[model samples]
Target: MDEGCDGTGLCIDTGDGEFMEISLHSRNSFERKKNPSQDSGFEDRGSKSKKKGLSVSDFLTRNLFSRKAKESEDDAEQGWKLFGRIPPKQAPDKDPQQITQEFQNKLRSVAQPKNSKKSDIEVMSTTALILENRPQNLPTKDPEEAEKHRQQYEAMVEAARKKELKELKMKKKQKQQQLKNEDKVVCAAKRWTDEILPNWETMKSQKKTRELWWHGIPTNVQGRVWQLAFGNDLNVTNELYEICCSRADDRIRMTIESSEIYGNSETSSEPPSSKESSVELIKLDVSRTFPQLCIFQKGGPYYDLLHSLLGAYACYRPDVGYVQGMSFIAAVLLLNMDVADAFVCFANLLNRPCQVAFFRVDEELMKVYFHTFEEFFDENMPGLYSHFKKHKVTPDLYITEWIFALFSKSLPLDIACRVWDVFCRDGEEFLFRTALGILKMYEDLLLHMDFCNLVQLLTKIPEDISGDTLFKHIDTIRMNIDKKRFNQVLAVNKES
Candidate 1:
C-alpha cells in the first residue's frame, strides 16, 4: 500500500491533519468547456524541469517512485531523485493498525476546497497516478470492515461528484449568460416589448421583424411573440376559448361515453375524421401525452389545460378534429402560455398554408412532405440518403412524428425550445432545414449505423446538450439548403 491509502483515494498526512489528495469531479448546470487546462490534471509528466507553482514536499509526493523506478540506471539521465519503496519494518515500534487508523482520521479531517481553482486542479492532478494504482478492496477481506470502508468511500465520492456537478452547471450558466449579453437581440426584444406589440406592428406590417425571432426570444415574452408572429389575437381572448371549450366538452363527453355504440370503437386506431371519433381518440391519447413531464401528469392542472386546449381546437375546427400528434403539440403550447393562448397558437400552427392537410385520413399531403424530404435528403446528403433507401427506411416511418409534433418528441426539451424559436420565425420551411441539420450534425455517426440502430438513434431523445450548440448546427446547415429547389418540390407534390 502507498503512504496514505484510503479506501477510494490515497491520502498523505505529513504528521499534520491536512490531506494532499483532492477529488477532480465537480457539479454545474451546463457542461464545462473541455479545454486541456480544465480536463486533465497532470501534463508533461516525462519533462526534466521541475513542476512550477508546487512546494518541494508537493513535488516529491507527485513524483514518488516504486523500488523498480528508483533502481533505474538512468536516474542520472532523468536528473531527479526517485524515492525507493519503504522496507517491511516497524514504524518506531508502533502497531501498523494504529498508524493506518490515525492516517485515515487525518484524511477525514482534511476538508475539501471551497472552490475548484487552477491551484486545486494541480493538487487533484497529483492524485491521478495513485487513482490508477489504488486497490479495489482491502487485502484483508473482513466483510464488515470492508463494507464500512466501501460505504464511507462511496459517500465521500458521491459528495465530491455532486459538488463537481454544481461547478459545471454554474460554468455553463455563466457562459450562456455571457453569450446572451453579447447578443443584440436581447436589446431589440426589450425595446420592442417596452413599446408593446402595437408599435411593433409597424415592423410587422413591413414584414421586417420576423428575423428578430431567430436571434432568440426571451422566455417570458416568447408566447406573446409567437402569438404576434402567427397573427393570433382571437384565442388570446378568454371568452372565445371558453366558448370553444363549452362546445368541445359536450362533443368530448358524447364521443367518450358512446364510443363503443358508435362506429368509433374504443380499440380502433383507424384514420379518424368525424368529430366523435376524433374526441374518442383524443381521450384515449390524452393520458399518454408527455407522460413523463410533471406538468402533464394525469391529474395536474396542466393536464386539464392540455385536455381543454386540444378539445377546444377539436370543436373550433371540426374539419381537422383531434389528431394523434396534436396532444404533444398542445402540450408544448400549454407549456408556453395560458390555455386560451395555447389554443390559438395550436390552431394557427395547424392552419398554416398546407399543414392542415397532414391530418386528413388519406394522408396524401403527409406523403408529399415525406417525398419532398426524401428528395431534399438525396440532394443534400446523398450518402445517408442512399443508406436509408438501401435499408427501405423512409421518412414516413419516423418523420411523421417529427413533422406533426414539430419535433417535440424527437429532441431534448431545451433543444426543441430553441428549434421552436426559429421555427416560428422562418415558418414551415425551417422544419425541414432543422431535420436535415440534425442529420448533417451527426452524419458521421449515421453513416456507421445499421438500419435498426439508425432508427433507434434517431428516435431516442439525446442527453442534455447545450441548446446554443444545436442552434449553431441548425444555423450552419440551414443556409446551405436550396429554397428554390424546395419550392419546386412543394409545387410538384402539391400539383400531383
Candidate 2:
C-alpha cells in the first residue's frame, strides 16, 4: 500500500489496483487505536521519514490549505463586510462541552461572596445580561456633530418663541390706538353738539357746521340733529299722534274681526276703506323693511312699533298715504328717536314739496325733475349720458326709485344715512347732484354695460360702494339747480 495526502484527506493505493480516501473525522478512532508501547518506535520511524521526504512539513501544509478553504466558504455565506468596512475575524465555534464549562466559569465570576446579600448578586447578573444581549454592529457617534445638532434645535425653538411674542405686542398696540381714536371722535362730537349746534340761527359758523354736516353727523346726537334739521312746521302734536294711532288700532281691530270699518267719515262703513287698505299694506311692508335688522322682523322688539308708526302716518295723510318705500324712511326715524318724536319728524319730512311730488308719483312734477337731472347729467358727464341714450336707458327708470326711496334701498344703510345727512342740510338741489354723482362714480362701468345690465346696476346700485369715495365724487359735481330754480322750471313746464 502507498499513502499520500490531498487538501481534504489522506489517499491510500492498494496493490489490487483500487484507491480509497480517509476522512479527517477518522483521526479520533485512529488515536484510540494507538499503543503507548509502540509510540517510541513510530516516533523514531517518523523522524527518519521527515529527514528523507519532509513528511511533517507536507502534513502541516495540507492542514493549512484545508482550513483556509473552509474559512473562505464560511465568509462567503455570512458576508465579508460590516458597516461599510471589512469586519474582524470571528472566533471559532465551541463544542457543547466547552460551552458548558465557559458558562460555569462565568457564573462563578459573577456570583457575590457567600456572605454577601442576594440583591447584589441579582443586580450584577442583570447588568451582565444587558451587556451580553446588546447589539454589536452600531457605529460610534461624533461628539461635535451631535452637539451641533442639539444647539441648532434649541436656537430654532427660541426664535419661534420670540416671533410669537412680537406679534402679540403688535396686535395689542394696534387695538390701543384704535380705542384712543374712537374716544377722540366721541369727545369732539359731544363738544360740537353741545356748543355750536344749539345757537345755529345767529351763528356765522353755520358754513363750518354745513361743512361738518357734509362729512357726517356723529351718531351720538344724530337724532337730535335730524330733528332740528327737519323742523316740525306741520304743527304735529303728541295728542295728534295719539289720536292717529288710536284710529289705526280701531281700524286694524275692526278689519281683523271682519266687521264694517268706517272710512274718513264715521258714517260710511265701506269694504276696507283707504285707511284699512293702508294698514294691510303697512303690515306687508313692516316685516319686509330692513330685513337685515332683527328689530324690524315680525315679533321683533321694534316690529309692532314700526307697524303702529306707519299705520298712524297713513291715517294722518290719506292724500299722500303710506307709499311702498315709506317704511324704510319711518324705520330710520324710529331707530334714532322715540315713537312720538319719530311720528312728528316723519310727518314733517313727508311734507317737504320735493318729497310730496315724489311720494304722490305725480307725472308732471316727475317729468320736470327728470328734465333737470338729465341736463345736469349731460353737463357733468356727457360720455355716460351718451352711453345711457345708446342703451335707451331713461332717467325715469332708475331715478324714480332713487328719489322716492331717498336712496335707502339702493345704498347700504350707513351710507344712505350719510347721504340723508347731506340731503337734509343742502335741500332738493343736492338730490340732483347726488344722482349725477352716482352716475359719475360708476361712469367707467356704466359706459360698458347694456340696457338691462345698466338698469339693474343703477336701480340696486351695489352695496360695496365706498361711502368716502361716493361722497368725494358727489362733492366734485357742480350743479346750478337750487330749490327755487327747480320750482320755477316746474311752473314753466306746467304752464306749457
Candidate 3:
C-alpha cells in the first residue's frame, strides 16, 4: 500500500507498491493552516496565509519534488496571472450525482413532448396531408382536424390525376389520326406508278435510235434543215438552239459557232469540240424545258404526281433551277424507281447533312474538298503543285465543274450513270476517290509532261477517262483510302 498526499493535504491509500512523496514545504504549510505554528520562524504568517500561503522557496521546492503540490501551485499562478496580479475566486466543488441530475433536467426542457393529441395513425395521415396539400399553418395538436384535411387533399389529387390521364388519351388519339392522314397522302402519291402506261423499267429500256442525216445536205441546206427539224417543236432541244442563235453576243455566239463547226465537221485538222459545248447546250435546254414539261400538259395522275414533286423541288431550290447535271442524276433514278420514289431519293440527297452543304451558293463548303485535294496533291504528287504553279493553272478552272456537277458533263452518259450509282451510295468521299482515280489514270502523261503540256493533257482527259479503265482506277482508289478515317478528318475540319 502507498500513501499519497493530495493538494489539499488529504492522504489517500493507493493499493500498489508505488509511493507518492509530498514536499516538506507542502506538509508544513498544511500543518500551519490546520494548527498555527508557535514560532514566528515562519516569516509573516498572517500576510502569508492571506496571500496564497506559499513562499517563493516553498513554491520552487514543491514544483521540483511533489506532483500534486506543483499542479496546485501552477493553477494558482495561472489564475493570478489571468486576473493581472489578483487571484480569481475558486469554484466550489459539486457532487457527481447532483451534476448528472441537473443535466438531465435541462435535456427534458428541450425534448419534444411524448403525449401528443394525435394518435399514431392520425399523425401518419396528417403527415401525408402536409405532403399533399402543404398548408401554411397546420393543426398538429388535434387529430380529427388533421384527418379531415388529409381526406380533402386525397380527393383533390384523385381529381387531378383523372384529368391528366384524360388529356393524355386525347392527345394520343389526335396524333394517331394525323399519322393516318399522312399515310393516305403517301399511298395516293404511290398509286400513280400502277396507273401510268409504262413502268420505270420499260421506260428505261425504251430505245429510240433515230439518226438525222446531214450527209448530202449542202452548206445552204443546213439553215433550212435546222429550222424545219427544230422550228415546229417547242421542246427543250430546239428552244436551246433558238436561244443560242438569238444571243448574237460575241462570247455566246462564238461558243455556239465553235460548237457547230467542230461538232458537225469531220475534218482531221481542226481542234476537237470542247466538252463545254455539249454542257452549255444541255444547261440551256434544262433551264428552259423542265418547267413547261412539269405543267402536266397530258393531264394524267402520273404527270400530276411527277409535276408536283419535281416542281416543288425546282421552286424550292431556284438557285440550282433544274440544272442539266440533276437531270442525269434524276434520269438514272427514274430508271429504277417511279418519279415519286426518284423525287424522294433526290430530296433526301439534297436534304441530308453530308450532301446539302456542298450545294450552297456561297460555295464555302466546297472548300473542304478543295483543301483535302490540296493536301493529297502535296503529299502524293509534290511535282504536280510545282507544275501547276509553273503553268499558273488554278485548280478552280477544272475542279469546280468536276466536283459541282459530279463529272456529269465531263463523262459520257453510260459512264456518268455508273459513277453516280456509287456516288449516291457512298456520299462525298466518292468524289475525292473519283478525282484521285482521274489523276492516277493520267499519271503516265502527268509525270512525263511539263506544266504547259500537262494543262493540254488534262484538257483532253475528259475524253481519255471514258471506258472500263476509268472505273477500274476509281475502284482502286476507293479500296486504298479509308473512308471512315477521311470522314473523321472532315468532321474535325468542320469543328475547327
How high is each candidate's TM-score? 0.60, 0.61, 0.36
Summarize candidate 3's per-residue lDDT along 61-144 as a digit string, tens digits: 555757567666565445332223443567788999999999999899779666543322122222333334335596453677
By TM-score, the better pick of 1 and 3 is 1
Q: Candidate 2 — which residues are off by over 4 angstroms?
A: 1-184, 259-273, 481-496
**Which residue segments of model 1 deviate by more than 4 Å?**
1-189, 195-198, 204-212, 233-238, 255-276, 478-485
The deviation in Å at residue 61 for candidate 1 is 55
lDDT of 2 at 471: 89
Candidate 1 residue 198 C-alpha distance from true site, Å: 5.2
Cα RMSD to the true fold for all candidates: 25.2, 26.2, 32.1
Write the candidate numbers in order of decreasing TM-score. Answer: 2, 1, 3
- Please report the TM-score between candidate 2 and the true structure: 0.61
lDDT of each: 0.66, 0.73, 0.48
